[model samples]
Target: MIEQLQAFTDSLPPAVQWIVVIGLGVIPFVESYSGSVIGVLAGLPFFVAVPAAILGNVASMLFAVFAAHRLRGVVRGDRSEAELSPRRAKLKQRFERFGVAGVALLGPLALPSQITSAATVSFGASRNAVILWQTVSIIVWGAGCGALAALGASAVT
Candidate 1:
């Protein structure tokens, strides 16, 4: 799947390639980290690829956070209470222990920024804080992965 995406990205005109990279970055599972890797592997300049990926991912995550914040407001007004599933129970436990920053930074290992940001917002974390931390995480992960992929591509060439 990644290889196919890389081929597609590589086929684009150089002037607009970063746009496709940004689009890739907006996907859920294929967020900034994978987008950066794809962009770098597809021969985009590192400066263009990493920042584009981060921008797209952050945009998507911001949408999720805001939507979740609004949803949480509506849900909070309701009287219903439901038990957490086992998986959700575990996630809640981690969130309780780690707080927003830790979860934002490490959540990418288990879930994309969109899901994680939404979840964090649903759990009643401050929306602005989630945005700040998630942005930091996106940039760090995107730049780091892009750098590694660039190094590997250079080595192979």
Candidate 2:
């Protein structure tokens, strides 16, 4: 799937390719880290690819955070209806165990940042705090993954 994304991105003009990267970044599982790596593999520069992916991911995440802020009241109003599924239960447990920073940094390993971020906010975590930590994680993970992708691509060539 990522290889197909790479092929499709490579076929577009550079500006549109960035747009494609950003589009993929907005996807929950794709996110900035994999989006940046896909961009790098599609031949975009690391600087451009990483930032574009981060911008898209952050934009989508902000939307989710704000949406969660509004939905928190509704969700909270109905305790019985809001009972978590086992997956969400585990996510909530992780949030309890790790807090925002640890979850922000490591949550993607288990679930998309979107899911974790929303879950955190639903648990009454500060929106601004979650956004801040998510930004840091996005940058770190995107850059790290992009760098490794570049290195691997170079070695393969």
Candidate 3:
């Protein structure tokens, strides 16, 4: 699948290939890291690829965070908290232990930024706080992974 995507991306006119990278970055599992790698491997300049990927991933994640925030507000009105399942209890424990910053920073290791950002908001965290931390996390992860991919790609060429 990745090979096919890369081939497809390579087929586009070079002037607009970064646009496809931005679109790929918006996908959940693909996100900025994979998107940047794809863009670079598809022969985009590193500068163009990484930033485009980060922009798309951040935009999508922001949407998820805002939607989750709105949904939480609507669903939480005047209701007592329901009992959590054992799975949810464990997740809650982790959330409490890690807090927003830790989760935002480390979440990409386990899940996509969209899921992490939304979960943080659903936990009643401040929306601005989640956005701030998630942005930081996205930038760091995207840049780090993109750099590594660039290095590896150069080594092979």
Candidate 4:
């Protein structure tokens, strides 16, 4: 799967490689970190890969957050308490224990920011707060992964 992802990324023109990374970054599991790493491994420069991945992840998360926020009331309206899954319950605990910043920052390690952001919003967190922290998380993760790729590339050369 990783080889396939790298191959697909490499098949793109260098001038628009970032676009491919952006599309990958928007996926839940792929996110900015993996997408940026794939971009770099596919021969994209750190400057192009990192920012594009972060932008894509952030854009998708923002959209999800806004949508969830808009529909929070309606979704929660008739839902029974018994419908909550163990995963949902865990996320709720994380929100209560860590608040928006902790959950947003650490969310990528456990789940996609898109999922976490939606869960956060559904749990009644402020939309503005989730966006702000999630942006920080995306940037940090993208940069970290990009740096790792640079180091790996250098080692190979």
Candidate 5:
């Protein structure tokens, strides 16, 4: 599985690297695995993989946050518009109740990384706060996975 993933990443051209990074970063499972695979394929050390993955993940999170903000405007419509629709109100309420941790961790598991990050931001969570927690989570998870894959690769070789 690891070798196959590595080969796929390695086959991609340099121009495709950014695309892969963004695509994997926005998605859920791919964000969790693609960075490590790319690192191994590129002949980068595990330490490098961890940071690269974290950066990709962070970029995705920022994109989501911006999207969520834009969605809020769309949902709210004009200032002259009376009140939020039932669905919009419900979403706002849910986000308000769940708070940052809900979106930061559980959201990623349930939805795409971008959606999760954006939802958290749309709910009026501080951007810095969300970024801090999400970055930490991404780094920790990416590092652990990268380290494990590197160790396994070394053992097999």
Candidate 6:
């Protein structure tokens, strides 16, 4: 399976490679699955892949941050129904009560990356804060995954 995936990614053009990286970064499931695997499949050094995945993930976080900023008014409409649901409302309130650090640490574990981005924005978090925290989370998680992958690659070889 790994070899087949490697062959597939290897056949793609450089532009497609970047697209794949970006796409994988944006999609939560793909982000989780590809975070480590894509780098290994690309035959990149662990250092290269780790940073690339972190950068790609950060790129996606940037997109979410900007989108949340732009869509803030739309998401938080005049009516309560137009806004996030009651459950999301409760979660946002919790984050608001606890402050940025709680959201920064627990958000990734509890929600999809994009949802967490949106939640932070909706909860009136500063754009810079969201970007900073999300970047940190992405780097930490991506590095951990990359290290595991590199270890596995070494073991297999």
Best by lDDT: 1
In order of listing, the candidates' clash counts read 0, 0, 0, 0, 1, 0
List where candidate 5 sits over 4 angstroms from the true fold. Answer: 1-28, 41-43, 74-97
Cα lDDT, all candidates? 0.89, 0.86, 0.87, 0.88, 0.66, 0.69
Preferred candidate (lDDT higher): 1 or 5: 1
lDDT of 2: 0.86
* Candidate 4, poorest ten consecutive residues by summed lDDT: 1-10
What's the CA error at residue 105 for candidate 5, in Å? 2.5
* RMSD to the hidden true structure, all candidates: 3.7, 4.1, 3.0, 4.1, 4.3, 3.9
Between candidates 1 and 5, name the one with more favorable TM-score.
Answer: 1
Please provide, for model 4 over 65-130, each residue's C-alpha lDDT reduced to its tens digit, 9 standing for 90 to 100.
999998998768878767889998876776789999999988988999999999898987999999
> lDDT, candidate 2, residue 104?
92
Q: Rank by lDDT, highest first.
A: 1, 4, 3, 2, 6, 5
Clashing residue pairs in candidate 1 (N, C-alpha, C atoms within 3 angstroms): none
Residue pairs of candidate 5 with colliding backbone atoms = 64-118
- Compute the lDDT of residue 60 as modeled in candidate 5: 74
Clashes of 4: 0
Cα lDDT tens digits for candidate 1, 17-96: 87888999999999999999988887788998999999899999999999999998987786443655678678777788
TM-score of each: 0.85, 0.82, 0.86, 0.82, 0.65, 0.74
**lDDT, candidate 2, at 17:** 80
TM-score of 5: 0.65
Tens digits of per-residue lDDT for model 2 on 45-82? 88889999998999898888889988998767857636
Tens-place lDDT digits, model 5, residues 1-157: 7667666766877556555554555556667456755565554556556566667777777777777777777875665424667897788788778777766666545665666676677666777787776776676666777777787778886
Question: Candidate 1: what lDDT?
Answer: 0.89
**Predicted candidate 3 versus true structure: per-residue lDDT over 1-157, tens digit per residue:** 6456667767888657867888988999899988888788777778989999999999999999999999988987766546566886688788989999999999999999999999989877899999999999888988888899889888876
Candidate 2 residue pairs in backbone clash: none
> What TM-score does structure 1 among the candidates reach?
0.85
